[model samples]
Target chain A: MTAVLRRPTAAAPRARGRRRMLPFSPRHIALIPIAFVFAVPLLQMFLAALSPSAELIQYPPPFIPSHLTLSGFQRLFAQSDILRWLGNTVIVSVVAIVSNLVLCSLAGYGFARLRFHGKNFGFFGILATIMIPTQVLMIPTFVMFASVGLTDTLGAAIVPWLASSFGVFLMRQFFLSLPAELEEAGLIDGCNRLQVFWRIVLPLAKPALATLAIFTLLGAWNDLVWPIIAINNPGAFTLQLGMANFQGVRRTDWALLMAGNVVATLPLVLFFVAAQKQFVATMTFSGLKG
Target chain B: MVTHTAVLRGSPSRARARRLGSAKRTVEGWGFVAPATILILGLSIFPAAWAFLLSLEKWNGFSTPTFLGGGNYAEIVGDQQFWDAFGHTALYVVLFVPASVLAGLVLALLLNGRIRFVGVYRTAIFVPFVVSPATTGILTNYLFDQQFGIVNHVLGVVGLPQQGWLTDRHQAMLVIAIMSLWGSAAFTTVIYLAALQDIPAELLEAAAIDGANRWQAFWKVVWPELAAVTVFVTIWQTVQATQLFDLVYTTTRGGPLNATETIVYYLWDTAFHQFQFGYGSAVAYVLFGGTLIVTLIFVLVSRRRSSEVI
Candidate 1:
């Protein structure tokens, strides 16, 4: 059933959408309160993190402290291996980022461009794994890694993440949107398939690659459960595990715990802010397609 | 779509080139995808089969397995704590999903119209989504602490009644729900915000010219356009809520009286805490089955609805 009714003519690039002549409208007045609801938790966390211990226990804690101090951060660095955990976090994040970029783009390119037997079923098999609950995989996967003696190492924490279902899906979607003619031209010019992909295709995939990198960075940095399941050694703790352990030992010490949370969370906050458009585009792409 | 185009172009070429060219293309294609297949399939599918096999046996983390057939599944069907966790999760999902969806959509609508500082507002909202769930758990635990927590402090200042948060069973659920909302809204809001932006302006203008006011125009014009997205958000949130482990694990650990224990958390507790690998695998399969059923319903319903509209 060959059905090609209409080639999708490129619509005008969706830029410069409906903008009112003046920025200030009755809408902005309405928006402030709603946005405030979303902003309050992060703000309160920051304020609490900044408050001195005396100020924190003073009956009713003030949102704006009379004076702010870095005693908590100082004590955090002085007492614990917070710096080591942050390093481990960076390693996992960077490895996961690079691996997802290369592996997912390669697989996504195969799904999008190449012709092979079992291609449809193979791709669908990958997609189906997205619906399989992560908990089901937990026991077997942990055992699988432990069998290979990689359980408490960084390898255990990052192996499953080297390629993600969502990363592959996103890359494939981006690749599909690209015109096949670009790759065909490379093939006609006596280039092999891999060369065509590396030279002619990958340069144009900067946006998709950026999206994959940001997604992996966020996922790897913020990951908690897998590290908990896989790595138990105190020295091997990822950032989240380190922060969790810090909270446990310093139970009532809200100042230090909140400070730890802020320290751990700040990089991701900075990352998202730097790549806001890419983040939003990824969100949009996933939602709209689903 | 790309695959369809490939098939269309591939057919005529196959007539002249026959199997050898196709065979060579297949090998090249496999070469590209094999690395991912080896990794993903090894990590995903192989484990799933292993899990299913483990579910049918009775084994702890150690010792040789004793085959128990359907005994674990039978036990799960009659388990009280399992059902208790199930009820707790249902309640959590009930409170969390609709509220986040509605809150996300409303904020998206408010922020939709050409506005200033949208990026600033978005960063403020989306910041929560990027923070580690465990970090969020720590932050919220402090915020909702009954006696010295700032949430209680603010409530007292506002002359509102101070109830025990993170203390009472029902109140603990509310606290977790609030925390879930704080973490979840950013992603949902971004989705809704983008969908709102994509709604063509001409459709809204057409409704206005037909004498529809803003609210009526939104209902008649914009609402239908967003139905698919709303469904997507709903299902995404549902699956995410069902896998709600890290937040509860960090905050309460199934808490004061098992009031907040969810399917995933309980699965973790059973598998890891009790070292009952077989039993844990059974519970995992149950969760997987339930998720698959729910997701299938959503997909089928949405598919039929879209096809009818076309």
Candidate 2:
């Protein structure tokens, strides 16, 4: 069993070296254009943001800018509430990440380890809610929030994201995959369940927690429709909501719009680049289980 | 919920002590799960139930709601605008799902091999998936702009006549589909790549040794292995396609003549724009019911096929 597992890792580097020595391969021939096509939208967004306002209005604007300018960004900052919107988005995303990590982990650990009656019923019930489309729930949710005076408030945006069924499911899956022995040892050493989870299990669960945090951040940050419905107050707008409204109201201002898109998109792209491995891992995990 | 008295009554003293310990565990378990349970119930399940109740009432956001007794649903059956939006949504699903799934599968197969700059290619392809759909839509509007967009510029450079892109009713939905694919195909690619890596190398090697060519081996082996992932991607994409609000809201606002008015967009227009909350909830239910039926069909069919394969 050990040899079988070890052979693939042992063979990987040598195989990579051999492939590296080949000057060109059919795969490269096929992939180059595909990658370029996939990458053009992002490149376009950045370049267009840098293009001068005068040039953007021209017929068939230059693919590459005449000369880069920060005028669009300057105008964006000067004229809009973009910074305020971005701050609100950050607050929403951070609260979401922290709440999801805490609430989902506690609930997930309980579902994974605790022997409560109706545990199966409760867990599956939560899981089943994943299929209930968010579009259908929005009206009632909006009404409920309005009744509680959450409408048009940042709290409206923050409430729905506090915890997610997917987060709980993810944490539970991660916890289940862990060897229970370490937790059992903690329990034997006179640590209670909560302590065993916090001190031992949570430290080991760093990867899952990171994955959950990244997903939660992405979801909360990019959320558009709910925020638009629930928060019309300009002061409470999240970045995506603000950008959408900006685009609608100022459709003619190409440079400003592009700059706004850049501002909205760049942070996430940079975050993905910084944590590329974790981002990919999160995608793979979600794809497999989703 | 768990009754302590029943456990103690049926047990000896030692057993009673253990039962008490289990009772304590049950309480602790509930304590751990309570927060998430309450939140999910309050925010998701309760709202879903309320949506159903709201569907059967007539209200205009401010006035007292009068019970409609399925009148909203009855109107929906004959509502021409609702049907048009539903048709548009269907068109979007038809256009978006297969194209993205196929493109993703092709890209994944291409990347699955040992190659130079594999990391660069993967990153380039997957970056778009990370961008918000609203931003993608904004970019699409500019890139495909009728007059000054780069897409038309490229067409002009090649001597083809420039066409109105998003501004034209005939072409708007297709443009939306292409933009959506650009943003989403990478997701399916990532999933497919992972599934491809899981195929045992030895199985492919054995097929090669037995004189099967690459294409044959792929069809006879790799293709079958991809069935599950394909189903997942299709269902996910279809669900996403149904909730196609962000893109339309940003770019078209369901127009160049409502050509892109999807069900969700229509529902939003109804409830929020027109303040017809009751009718909008009914529309929401229709969409929910349709999505549920479609998803159930996919799951059931996949289960049967997998069982047959076994």
Candidate 3:
């Protein structure tokens, strides 16, 4: 066994030595063109946002803007209900984030650690629900919401996103991976299940909760289809629905559209930058650990 | 309710106590899931059910739906336009989904190491996922625009003719496909990267010691572990492909003689534009039905595969 282990150990050194054969291996460089292609769209959006009128629409669009301008953004803020849309989006997303953190955690913890009857069965049922396409549910949901007179409210946007099957599943998986000893100790120390969950597991779950929040917020913020279907009133339009109005049937106002894009995209970028490290850490932990 | 609980609890009085406890737990459980469940069921499931009922009717959005029964279904089956849209979607899946899966997998495999700037590469690949698809669609529109787009401009320098990218029926779907790949490949890559990282290093070393080449090791060991990720990506891509509204809506508006018109786009037009709620509901149901069948098939296949593995 020792001899066999020694051969593999020795092989590692040879592999390291062989690494010197290429200055920059071709494989590593293969990602460059693809990454560049991915980055170009974002760059152009930035360029379009900066370029002056007639410049953006000009044939053979300018590769780079001669001078940057914030006119589009200013126009966006000045004309449209951009601020209202932003406020609406923030409200919906914040509600979704908070609710998901609490509700998903409770359900996830229940499924993960608590000894409940039909636990496995319930989980599998939830898992099975994942396969049902959301498309089928949309029309019925609209009718139901309309009956309750909740059709035009932000509540329609906020509520559906809060209880994702995936969020519960993610949290459950994370909870299962955690050592039960800590929670068990808390229990022995006169902590009930709810108390143990509140003080012990909740703090430990910041990363997963954040990841859930990020995804939930992004989903809620960028949602176009539901808002379009649910809200005909301009007062209720989220940023996406509000911005889409720029593409009029006859002619699109590219400047306003570009402005709207910038306004809509900025918050997401800020959120990503602020929580990027935590986001990445959680992604790897939740996705890979499974 | 008390008697029902008593029966379940086995001793009448004990059962009563258990019933109360269980009822409270059930209520709590429902409360936990209430907001989301209610909304989803209302907005999603309820709409779907009403749509299905509407599929059997003939109504404008404003009018009372007249019963059409199976006529709409028959009409959909005979509708050449629906088939054309379906064909476009199939073509899209063929061109875009596989190419994306391969690109994502390759990126994950290439970057699944402690290389210098690996984090940078990973982030660069994933940045697109966070960017709005509508923005990406617009950017791609300009890039691949025939006359003055950067793509044709590049091709022009290469002495190649500028293709009518968004305007040409044949090329329109390709441009949208490319945009779709650009927007979604990042998420797929990240998921694949996660899957790749889960692969044990010892397995690779063991395979290498057994004289398996890098290619052999990847196929035998790495690919199996990635099977789940592959399924996830494929299902996601398929669903996203069928729901190909955003990019198509933004870039082509299902235009250039409806070359890029997907089922969802068609449905949107029927319901929102034409006010043919009943007909649109039929289309929606058909799409839902197709998706359901596909999902069922995938689930069955995966389950069987798992069983076989076990």
Docking class of 3: acceptable
lDDT of 3 by residue, B79-108 (tens): 998999899888888889898888888776
- What candidate 2 gets wrong by more than 4 Å, as runs, is A1-23, B1-12, B303-310
What interface RMSD, in Å and to 1 decimal, does model 2 have? 4.3
Ranking by lDDT: 2, 1, 3
User: Candidate 1, clashing residue pairs?
Assistant: none
Residue A126, model 1: Cα distance from true site in angstroms: 1.1
The better candidate by lDDT, 2 or 3, is: 2
Candidate closer to the true structure by DockQ (higher is better), 2 or 3:
2
Q: Score the docking of each candidate (DockQ).
A: 0.41, 0.52, 0.29
Kindly give the stretch of ten consecutive residues in candidate 2 chain A with the minimal lDDT sum: A2-11
Write the candidate numbers in order of decreasing DockQ.
2, 1, 3
lDDT of 2 by residue, B213-255 (tens): 6678788878888898889999988988998999999889999
lDDT of 3 by residue, A91-112 (tens): 8888888888887888788877
Q: After superposition, how far is residue B81 of candidate 2 from its true place, in Å?
A: 0.5
**Which regions of candidate 1 fall more than 4 Å away from where they truly are?**
A1-24, A288-290, B1-23, B299-310
Candidate 3 global CA lDDT score = 0.71
CA lDDT for candidate 1: 0.81
* Model with the higher TM-score, candidate 1 or 3: 1
